[model samples]
Target: MTTSKQALPPVVSTATWQKELAALRIREKAVTRELDSVAAQRRRLPMTEMPDYVLEGEDGPVRLAEIFGEHPQLIVYNHMWHDGAEWQCPGCTGFTTQFTRLLGLEKFGARFVIVTQGPIDQALAYKRRVGNAMAWYSTANSSFGSDVGAPPDAGFAVNVFLRDGDTVYRTWHTDGRGTEQLSHLFGLIDVLPYGRQEVWQESPEGWPQAPAYSKWATSQEIAAAYGEDK
Candidate 1:
């Protein structure tokens, strides 16, 4: 049986919504400009020779260079998967879902890879959830992650690299909002209350949201926390 959808309460689109759409477009252009600036700034990251490193993959131990595969730049995003945590971070997983495919990234002389400090299975499990099997690897106890600014306990962010001849350089990095800028769609839409018209995710009459709150809650916990009907 096809149950009819609930009708929303009568409402009028007034000044409230006017700035919303306009802000969205404004944000879209702003984000694009920000990205262009980021690209230009990326040219300044400290240079480093291809440092020796071991990354255990689905196959086994593989050196880092293999990811380049003739590409001049490498964009490795740390997915911030914690092994001992009760659950995976849905926010991070959700963001990765918006991440463009490697082919798209590779076309620009850049290849994106997700390196995690968590156990292989822990990280792999989350990746499988999003079906983002993009070139993933495990750093184990190596400082490669922290050295790049993502302390295991602190979580992960996007890090960009440039390969010039045999030398590799750390060019750019983004954390939180900066990382949110990684995906233009997420920046202009998800960050907004009404979101984009293309993806229909209308906010409830009043969706009370807390930007930063108590400890993060799991899906099940959230249901209980909101007194949502089972």
Candidate 2:
């Protein structure tokens, strides 16, 4: 196979490289500090009480509080869905794949799971198809998805909740680019020279560019990689 010519940055002396990196480091550190401050403010934000909506679990109907299990904090990723479709949203499918192990969350008194607009069986089937290890549930029969800003047939979202005894309160909800902080893939891609290589980013001239998500794979493609068919 033929490889395309790659555009590269100009070579510089060691001293010049270190000087430029150090200058950029100052801005990086400032951004880091600003993010920390935002996180601190998020921790202080007030929460709203949530109803004990019944969602479909692998077994049967379960209350939202019951899904929390023994954890006092619950983080639900609202996975996007398409009714009667063979595949679901690739963005959500790929994003949720990043969370294979969640035992680390339990140490912080938190549990992480997925809620989808698709039926429970379809969601679980897709979960198996993608080899996702997180607990999957269905909000198809409830308004929980819309209530938390991830309506049916909509995009993905991350919703945080705190449990006080039998009652649950919504602490925070984020969608769109707000979910980027949780993506290890995005975090690593953003540090590369090309930096996601997407058209919308403000990158230096001569950098390679493609439309957003052009490099992304569909759920079917990901599943097929795992030797799962149907």
Candidate 3:
């Protein structure tokens, strides 16, 4: 498969390209600093007490606080679900699958997991279908998902929590593109010259374009792509 050279950036001398990249580095540093500042403010945001909702876990029912395991900090990705569907939310499935190894987060007292509105069996089935690596739980028996911003048949969300003994507090919540930070796939795509190729993106004329999210694969597609057993 050969890539088209048309609509690509103009060919440039190595010295000129290096000079342009050096200038871009300054802007990249500024953005990184701004992100650091934002993270600092997020750490200072006030938290609210959260109920000890019983979520369905693999072994059995588990309390919200127990979801943190030995960690005091927890990051939950509230994955979207469609009732009785074979395929779960493509965006959520794709997003969560990117985080296959999160054991390192435990060193910082953090545990990352997925909480979906689907039944435990269904959620786990999708997990196996897509070969998701993060621990997953179900909020089907409780209002945890809805109260936390992932209402049924709605959208996906990322919620941060802090646990003190058996008590848990909601520290932060974000959705939409705010969840993009956790997606290494999107981060990599954004750096590409064509940049996601989504129609909503501001790209140079004649650049490849497709509907936003058109590239995300369904659970079945992902399973086949990775040769996961169905």
Candidate 4:
């Protein structure tokens, strides 16, 4: 339902193009409505247990509640760790970079965090590279990510969890950049077959299209480039 934009021939038919544009608009609205309904369902879903599990953190192990800090509703991005030794996901990094713009979501009483299979230190290091001030932690040895319906093995998704007093609730969640169609990284997923399964950025041409861990890479390159050591 999406077109790869290209310069049209000078003799392009205006009426035909107008019809195409109208179709695109209808498709866009349908997608938006569908996503909104999903968001609403997410917001209405019951919350997960609060004091249940503790994810790995920079200083040490920390409970889920501790990550909340001053806010009750927390946005957790289930980041994918590179396979085996290479320990970071490029697509996940793409979403993290959006944090600088998402700071405004704070006004809605929600905070963001990234939960990866990598350790806390490694997550923090990558977060630094992306220049995101958002909160991050690792599910390294915890089931926090899995139990929340976003298993670490599941690659990536944006999950919003809400906490009201001692009770907590689950809010919105999104798996595709089609929802984040506004982001450059997510927008680029259109060129791919899966359309950003690990939806991150709509990167410009020549940037690493898909990031994957390779046993072929040198330890230094992997560590610096994909958080291999972490």
Candidate 1 residue pairs in backbone clash? none
**Which pairs in model 3 have colliding backbones?**
none
Ordered list by lDDT, greatest first = 2, 3, 1, 4
Per residue, candidate 1 scores C-alpha lDDT tens digits across 58-167 of 77776676667699888888877666876556566555555545677667888878888887766666565455546678888566788887777677788877777656
Off by over 4 Å in 4: 1-10, 13-16, 48-51, 82-84, 130-132, 149-154, 171-184, 188-230
lDDT of each: 0.66, 0.90, 0.89, 0.64
Tens-digit per-residue lDDT, 167-195, candidate 4: 55565667754436435654564545444
When summed lDDT is taken over every stretch of 10 residues in candidate 1, the lowest stretch is 221-230
Alpha-carbon runs more than 4 Å astray in model 3: 1-5
For lDDT, candidate 1 versus 4, the one ahead is 1
Worst 10 contiguous positions by lDDT, candidate 3: 221-230
lDDT of 4 at 178: 40
Whichever of 1 and 3 has more TM-score, that candidate is 3
lDDT of 2 at 139: 94
Q: Can you write out model 2's per-residue Cα lDDT over 1-230, one digit (the tens) per residue?
A: 98658878888999999999999999999999999999999999999999989999999999999999999999999999989888888899888887877888799999999999998988898899987878999999999998998898778899999999999999999999999998899889988988999999998888999999998877877787652563
lDDT score, candidate 3: 0.89
CA RMSD for every model?
7.6, 2.2, 2.0, 7.8
Winner by lDDT: 2
